[model samples]
Target: MKSLVTAIQQRDGRALQAMSNSVPLQQAQPVREHTAQVFNELFKQLRATFPASMANFKDQEDLNEFKRQWTKAFAENNIRTIDQINAGMKIARQQENPFLPAPGQFIQWCKQGESLAVGLPDEDQLYELYREYCKMRGWREMKWPSNACYWMVTKIYSEMRSKSLTDSEVIKLCAKELRSMTARIKSGETIPAPVKQIPQLYIPTSKERSLEHLASIRKKLNLNPKSI
Candidate 1:
C-alpha cells in the first residue's frame, strides 16, 4: 500500500494527477460519480498499486467479499465519491510499507482526501501554475485551471509585481494565499465572479486643455423671453 504520492502533476518529479489540468488530475478530470464505478476503479488502482499485499485474494469470491465489506464500510464512513477514493489512494501510496491497510486506516486516508474534495490543486501545483501564469501573462489565450485559480494567481501576480523577490519568497506568500482560498472553497464559498475591468476615466488636468478650447462654449447672461 505504500507508494510516494504528491498531489502535484506527474511531471517535475511529482505524483498524483490531482493536478491533471495542463494547467490541474487523471490529466484534472474529476471523478464526481459516487457509485460502483468509483469503487471499482479504486479497487483496480489499489490492486495495481499493492499487488504483493493484495496477493492473498487469489480468487474472485475472495475479492468480491472484500469489496462488499469495504463498500459497506465506506458507506458508513461517508466515503461515497471517487474523489475521496483517489485521495485515499494518494495517502495509501505515501506509506512506507507494502502491507494492505486496515479498513479503518484506509477510512482515515479517505477522510484526509475530504479536505481535498474542493477539487483545487494542492498549493505547490498552483504555485507552479502561478509561475507559468506570470510567464504567459502576455498570451491572449491561456487555459487556466479554473476561475478560482485564475483569480488567485492573478491576485498573487499583481501583489508581487512591484516586489523584488525570489521564487522562495513568492512561494511563501503564494502558499499562504492558496491555503486561505482553499479553505474558503472547502467551506463551500464559491469564488466570487471576476469583476469587470473598468477603464480609467481620462480626465485631463486644467492645464492639459487650452483655456481657449474651454471658452468656446459661450453662455448668455439673459434669456430671450420674447423670441422663439
Candidate 2:
C-alpha cells in the first residue's frame, strides 16, 4: 500500500498497476480518488481552452486514454504548479499560430514564460556597468542587476582590453553587445545568471593593439589618427 502511493506520485503506471493488483480494493480507493480529482480538474481546463484542438478527441475511450497519458506527462515534466499552467496558457494566447500547440510545445512555452523575470533593468544600464569594470585591473568581481547587464559588460571589458579600443569605440561596442544580449534573452535562451563572483585579484598584461588596427578603428568612428 505504501509502495502503491509512491508509484502513483511518480506517475509510474507499471508499478502502480502491479501494486494495485496486490492491494485490496479499499486500499487502492484513496489513490484512485486523488488521480480522478487531478485528471478532471487538469484536462477540463485544457479542453475548454483549446476545444478546437481537442476535436479529434470525440471518442470517449480515446479521450479518457489521452487524459490518463497527459496526467502522466504533466507529472513527469514537473508541470504541477498553478503559475506554470497559467504561464503556458499566457504563451498560447500570445502565439501568432492559431492552432493549439503540441504538449511538448506547450511545455517549452511554460519554460519561456517563467524565464521572464520581473523588472530586468534597462539595457542602457550596461553603460554604467562597463564603467565600473574599467576601474579595476585585477581579477575582481561585482554584482550586476541583470544577466543581460553582466554579459554585455563582460564583452565590453574583453574588447576594450584586447582591441585597445578608445573610449568612443568601447561605448559603441558596449551598445552593440547590449542589443545582442537583450535579443538573445528575449528568444528564450538560458543566458548566464549574474551571480557576483568572489574576487581572485590576479592581473595580467593586456595585449597591445597594432597601429594599423587602431587606425582602422579610428577611421570607422570617423576620427583621423593625426587629430590626437
lDDT of 1: 0.69
Give candidate 1 misplaced runs (Cα > 4 Å): 1-89, 94-115, 196-228
Off by over 4 Å in 2: 1-39, 117-228
- TM-score for each model: 0.40, 0.41
Question: CA lDDT of 43 in candidate 1?
Answer: 85
What is candidate 1's lDDT per residue for 1-228, written digit by digit as tens? 123342332234444332344433342234323445667878898888899978888798998898877776776766776677888898788899888888788876775555456666656777898888777766445577777877888878887877866788888867667656756887788787655545567787777576434444322434343332
Choose the strongest candidate by TM-score: 2
lDDT of 2: 0.66
